[model samples]
Target: MSSDDPLAAALAAAGLGGVQPGDTRPPEPRIEVVSDDPAEPTGPRELWPEGIGTGVGSLPGTDPREASALVTGETPEFPAFPELPARGVGADMIGRTAGLLVDLAVEVVPTGWRVTARTGRDLRRARDLLAGDLDAFDDACDRIRPHWVKIQVAGPWTLAASVELASGHRVLTDRGAVREFAASLGEGLRAHVAEVAERTGATVVVQLDEPGLPAVIAGSLSTASGYGTVRAVRAPDAQDLLRDLISGIAAPVVVHCCADRPPIRLLAGAGAAAVAIDATRPAFTGTTAEPRALDAIGETWDEGVPLLLGLLPGTAPEREPAIGDLARAGYDLADRLGFDRRRLARLAVPTPACGLAGATPDWARRALTLSRELGKAFADPDE
Candidate 1:
């Protein structure tokens, strides 16, 4: 690679040129090692020390204050920086994350968000909206001083797949651009995490949402012209990028994919503490769940990677939902995989099956309330 190579220059320009984020180790199980001096504690670290259930980032409302109040009120122990995509424009997943990028900028086009030469109105709006959300969430936290808070961001593959290049190709199509954005995101997130941590005085957890990853791995995404499909991203390559991103994060990172056939094993190997998925999806429940998918999930759990199981629907169902009914799939997974039900509390968290941005306001509130109930149920049946 020449020093003047455009790819190299772009990466260097993004502050990622010669930087290795942290000591990123390959995902492995918690193993006890025999040592003479003070033996290191070999017990698995508790993933959730406080109250458990939380939403998958979004809700139904356009007002950040109302949404934050609802979120922190119901799921105070594990409240997320509520995402109000219903507010439109720069508030959607991709656009909102653009606000968190350090050096890159994006503008919304007819096709969707695209790379831009400089910071534009769309980018500024994203930043402003996100800033407003932070303020709203901060105020909400002031009342209930939770010990930990969660914040979501788009994972690199999902971000790349969603945003397009100036040439109209997806950013994931260009390796250099993918790394550049990933680096810029990491730098931006470091600052973002520090600020949130400082403001709330709580351990801030990061959730990396990867809704586009399954399609990227399968090469199923259509080109802008719809005449072709993007080339499948190899698993190792995906894991490498994810590892770097996860390692750089000072806070615990949860990689979430509510899609069918999420690459569970792949995500498990990428150094994430947990893999969040739609527990209620056909891919995860009953006879419909495929053998390979079951195996992938089983393997992930065996490696001590906790599963953030989305047990209830993001949108409310017709019938009244019950605690036992909401927890059936979780119990079944354990039975199918030969895990003790008692261990589910330590290994799983209850969340909505997906983002609740499309849910009715009533359902959104109900859903999170149920999540809290489900969390308590998972933790102790005798409670």
Candidate 2:
């Protein structure tokens, strides 16, 4: 690879370059290691609010107003526009993204929501629910004036994986349908971001959730027939579609996937300002069989991109982890990656390991408090 290649630069910085036989001397440090794209932002902290804590979207219950209040009050510095999936079909990820489609509609079916030839009551309900959530978000923000607010939607691949074509096949199975959906999603998100900014008086950051992406790329999505899997999507094609969708949006973008082996490099290559992953998962903690995942982490951080590390448990645990315990895990990661521990504060944002929608109300509140404290510990461990 050329010296200017971002992957090469990251590999060199992390001292992961290939070595020849009989080479005993230590590798020399490369001073110019950096992102291949000069246009890439300095770091995620630049786009993120000064506060270090945020949520992973979904919260428990059906009331948007209550969810918004809790999120803003707990994570005042970097509050996320709460997603309440517990509200049912239209309020889930696919239903929410379908609501954002410019000229398309979806209806609930026995299998799930499917693309419809025309608009219907199902689509209307999705839009209405989303609007109610936005209203609640605006009301909550008006009192606190958060510096930045985050909103998440299903990314193209996950959307395609979820919705079925009229023919009963997944939209991802048809190349043309995939492209059309991406265009519609991009158009709708641009308007959504603008409206949130207008209403909340805060800079908007968009997060593209793709929990189903690994399955999509791995050809593991069950065929509509329930006996087979869809064909795997090539890495380049997936990256290109994501890049196109992200480029069209006028906000800092974060790609989040809680998959055990999220395609970290592919997401970074697709123009994400930050990649969110469940850092507490075994794959990232060096206990899993996959070593490359850890290397991807090192390379990502070395390229000056920020990581939204999911350090807090999403559900209630027997007992919550202490601030020092969470801080130690971060410091350990830095040491393993050969980076300075101080970089954790500048390059990481603490979040729940995943969404807290399944937790009891009491555990949910405790999780957010712990997440906020973890962020504070990252900034000032001694305190």
Q: What is the lDDT of residue 159 in candidate 2?
A: 96
| Residue 380 lDDT, candidate 1, scale 0-100 | 72
Q: Which stretches of candidate 1 lie above 4 Å from their native place?
A: 1-46
Question: Please, what are the lDDT tens digits per residue for candidate 2 over residues 231-311?
Answer: 999999999999999899889899999998999999988999899999988888856636788889889988877888998
Enumerate residue pairs that collide in model 1.
Answer: none
lDDT for each residue of candidate 1 in 1-383, tens digit (9 for 90 to 100): 47887877876787567544452445556899777788667886546652379888999889999999999999988898899898889999999888999878899999999999999999999999999999999999999998888999999999999999999999989999999999999999999999999998788989999999999999999988899999999999999999999899898899999998888988989999899999887877877888888898888889988988898788878986888877777778888999887778777888998899999999999999998888888777545
Native-referenced Cα lDDT, model 2: 0.88
Worst 10 residues of 2 by lDDT: 42-51
Point to the candidate with the largest TM-score: 1
**Model 2, residue 261: C-alpha shift (Å):** 0.5
